[model samples]
Target: MKILALNGSPRMKASSTYHILAPFLAGMKAAGAEVELIHIRRLNLEVCIGCYTCWARTPGVCIHDDSMADVLQKFNTADMVIFGTPLYHFSMSGIMKTFIDRLLPRFEPWLIPHPHVPGVTGHPERVQKPYKMFLVSPGGFPEFEHFDSLVATFKQMARMENWEYTGEILRPGAEPLSRRSLQNLFTGYYTLLRQAGEELIRDGRISDNLQLQLREDLFPGGKEVFYQLAEGYWTEQMDKFKVPQEQRHTVPLLAKDLDSTPMAPAGSNITNDTSKTGDRYYVSNEVIMQTMTAMYDTKAAPNLQATIQFQIIPPKIDFDPGEAMWYLEINGARCDLHQGKTAIPTLSITTPYEVWYDIGIGNVDALEAFTNGDYEATGSQKLLNDMLHLFPRPEPGSDDPLAAELDTLMMGMPTAFNPEAAKGTNAVIQFILSGKGGGLYFLNIAEGKCTVQRGAAKNPTMTIHCPAETWLAISTGKLDGHQAFMQEKYRVSGDMAILLKFNTMFDTHTN
Candidate 1:
């Protein structure tokens, strides 16, 4: 089958419309369909003048000398045509509308009765050929309702042109698909698009179930969260461009003045304070508790079953009762919060309310606060370390480094440790890394808990010796661990069984 795809986004390859269209065409090509993609922005096509020269003066031939002739030739021969565009003003973009208007040469001037629908008159096609028409569009809005008018227009066009109206692929809240940090959340959506394309080629149509899945949100959060993130993104952009507050709607004339401007790093200015009528109000303990309960990430630790108790001490400000106690019960992806403490908690944190509030609002780093003795954690240290991973904070700035030094990476092992994989395991692993940023560190794993310390371990179950750079690359997924081992880039001594369980034991690559 031959397919022709027209991309009508002004941004061309950078547009979200192309992000969705590229994968679909890839899947079609993989399914043995010949595909041709054309970008309307790159074409030298003019707007239709409504001169009727194509219909009156000459039959089925346009008067304009431009790229539309080539497009028409390809459109006439293709078995299927895909129109990819970004939604503008509740309809297709202006460029797309212009492209559609230029196709008038393909239709005869005479009006005729609709072939399938009753009581409907439409223009007859100049050329009689069976083909399929599909629409692929992405909108900035967060509701599927925004695409209703566009979809209706396409359906009507298909009816008038005597083409099969294949199902459309519509994506709402599509801006996030272009963000590198959030790409993982849309992996399933991209895969679904590929499946839709393959199904259209092999099965003649996408399954009803798959179509429903395609319309689901790209991420788990609702529309409210999407709006918040979008607002944050635009605000950052405005600040980056140095647009004045009064002229925010207008584009800035000059480039960003980096030397004179002071910009806050992404994810650094989040706070829980609100101001109304010049009166400042801090978040109450109840609000904090509710936010924590809502922030639980079930997918991150699906098999984790534990209880965490928070004991908030008195604060300097006037808060009713000044102190509070709360406990969170986590059982295999489910988490419930209670007002009071549980009888037995796997981990208990005791800290001043102010300190806890600072950490909650991202004003202070949680790990740094813990290391500085601002908070006291008792019971299982492993649980204390895994708290951030279980309920991860909002993503850090995109500029954050993907890799860290040996000390920082070693100390973060507990966060990536898989307790389920290391059940009933007790071992000591020693690492003597050489080179810059290297140090001597050892990990003690016992009773499904992991702890790291700076020193050599006596009678170690497994000892690894390697250059720090090589280990860092392996841990951060820059190099394959198994391949590095085979190439003798790193040497392991004693306890070959423990070495074999390294990948399953700790997910260091995620760090």
Candidate 2:
């Protein structure tokens, strides 16, 4: 079964909606369903103009390029669509809303699904199928005002395009969600998501008969009550309904692509009058446009793709192998909230493939699945996002970034561990690991040797101790440099700055 989960929170994986939706996706995956997750805030697509071009001129094409094009194809292949978001100012987030707007191109004037082929004759399937949703709001409220507003808006939009509205679950109170509650929510949510995915994958959209039954059970009061409750006129009466006074601001941008923006070439200048700051904010228009221009203008081959790798930890943005731009085919793409304000796990999918598959491709979004327990990742989010961004879209003929080529004929021999990288000649290796059973051990500088010990001051010179097991794993490639730190398998005290510098001098570890 194919399921597409759309996350509206810009904070990426940290968003509460992501948390709520993850378990559900896990359930689906466990049931043998294929799921794809698309965080709308991550897409570089632009907003839909009010132009009814899809209904008149281009038919099924929306003149924008950004990432919507990235989603349209995947949307068609899925049997279910799961929309997720936090209720902002009593409504859905601007990101998710704008995304829904751009989707206009996916529907014909008659609101039919676009043609899959030129003249093939087949059933005129509905534009979308019955779907489910998981929304996460920061705090709890007894009333359903916020939940109803979000669901109604999406429901109406789906209805206009011939989609069957399945059901939704509103998860209120973000931090208040305990591990126990999370598990329970996911158990039920997972079952429902997989069931929805399976039905869509097997029989296209849900049968009209089944859709009617599910709708009635969930809605209870039928369409009349639903429409009445949906009317904005009721909102005026709702203000007196007495709810929490919590004030929350929605995100400023949506999944629409900036690179695909149709405005005057951006002229190699992309700056923020006021920068939002952070990875969700990304490298900004200027950096990307500059990179794009540099890649295309260089005297290199016409097809050479250019890429820049940066390691940024605030007050410390460093570039490697010389801060020069090199032609690197965008061999792949990864989700780097390099700027997400929310705690959403920045996603990274690494492979040598030329093209990228969207969160909707597998009919599921990655973060959402992870949050719902439908997706599983082996490491910390920061580690995941960082590694994913390192996905090398290598320049067609460039050497591997991780491995250095010493001479023209042969590859350099790899090393197990280099004391030079971990320990420098600061009075002959003054290593220390303190507090709660943490300390240092000594290893050979030249012969690649080590003897791990427990007690204190055991010879301050040339020491290395990071949870013995981790130290062992490091030499064996069983542990990755990034994850080791995240997993607490690696932590350092004392001269960390100097410690990091050792990375440059040490013999590179290899498999």
Please name the candidate that would achieve the greatest lDDT relative to the true structure: 1
lDDT tens readout by residue for model 2, 1-511:
6778888888668776776567656655666778899998889978778788766777777777678876988887786678877778767788988887787765555433334434333334325455443333432332455467777786765554456666565654343232343355344443454454445445544455544432222223544544553464347556644333331121111212112122121222212122222332222222322222221212222221222222212211222212121112222221221222221112222211101111211122334434443223331344333322232111111343221121111111224344545443442233222212222222233333333321222223332324333444453467775577666554443445544544454443312
* Residue 314 displacement in candidate 2 (angstroms): 15
Superposed model 1: Cα runs more than 4 Å off: 243-511
Tens-digit per-residue lDDT, 426-495, candidate 1 = 9988775643355456789999899987544545688776666788888879988888888877777679
Any idea what lDDT model 2 has?
A: 0.43
**Candidates' TM-scores?**
0.48, 0.35
Model 2 residue runs over 4 Å out of place are 110-143, 178-511
User: Which ten contiguous residues of candidate 1 have the minimum total lDDT?
Assistant: 251-260
